[model samples]
Target: MSKTRCLLLAVMAYDRYVAICDPLRYSLVMNRGFCVRLVVGSWMAAVPIQVGQTYQVFTLPFCASHHLHHFFCDVPPLLELACADTFWSRVTLHAVILLFAVLPFSMIVISYVRIIRTVLKMHSAPGRHKAFSTCSSHLTVLTLFYGSATAVYFKHCSRDLADTDKYLALSYTVLTPMFNPVIYSMRNREVRIALRKLLWGK
Candidate 1:
């Protein structure tokens, strides 16, 4: 699920890139068939890699306590439970992170860089604002999702910081997703104005 989301987000960034950088070609470039292929391709790419990782983790002889420290069967927590030498497991985890998280994130960054350049070149102030506004929600969601994920996955996990990991995991897995709808919905001008009025009586 996480891997799929990352890839999907990358696809969205590409869609936005095409829309902003080459609006004339947007319809043709992001056609219905092409969109379907992108979605399907993301799933196809993520599933096999995830399955292989799951298989590798479960195959490890967990000689220690069967209880997981974290809320779910995450790779880091599962690795902690394994009594065997987890050199390869750790390697696989890093490999998966590089492929799913880092690579997709890099693609998003590149898309946004070009988007920023294109937006800056716009002569009309409203046009610039509209272009930046179009990306604000996506950028916000990306920051929240990737920030917590990076904090948890990229760090060296230790028993002393297990609680910290749980909180970070909760942010990415629960809180970030929970806020996604609200965040995206606020992209609408009416929604934003209403929200401001409700909060500040403006």
Candidate 2:
């Protein structure tokens, strides 16, 4: 699910890039068929890699206690229980993270770089604001999701760090997702006004 989300977010970034950088061709380029294929491709790409990783992790010999330190059956926690050396398992895990997380993140960054350049070139201040506004929610969600995920996964996993990893996992797995709808819905004017009223009682 996380990998699929990353890929879908990449697709969203591309959609925003075309919408902002080439507004004239946005409709033509992001047609329904293309969008469907992008979604399908994301699922197709994520499933096999995830399945393989799960298989690899479970296939390892388990001599330690079955109890997991983390809340879920994550790679880091599972690796801790493996009786084997786990050197190759850790290496493979990092490689998968690079492919699914880092690569998609790089694509998003590239899209935003070009978007910023295009927005800066616009003559109207309102136009610039609007363009940036369109991306603010996505950027916020991406930061929350990617920042915590990277912290948890890319770190050197160890028994001593298990507690810290669990907290970080909560950020991406629970908190980030919990806030996604609220963050994106803030783009709606009525929602913003209602929020102000609820907060300020005015």
Candidate with the greatest TM-score versus the true structure: 2
Query: What lDDT tens digits, residue by residue, belong to model 1 across residues 1-202?
Result: 2898899899989999999999999999999999999999998998898889889987999886998877888888888888899998899888888989899999999999999999999999999999998888889989899998888987765778899888888888889889999999987889989999999996
Question: Which sections of candidate 2 miss by over 4 Å?
Answer: none
85-153: candidate 2 lDDT, tens digit per residue: 999998888888888888999999999999999999999999999999999999999989888888888
On a 0 to 100 scale, what is the lDDT of residue 76 in model 2?
79
Total clashes for model 2? 0
Q: What is the lDDT of residue 41 in candidate 2?
A: 99
TM-score of 1: 0.93
Candidate 1 root-mean-square deviation in Å: 1.7
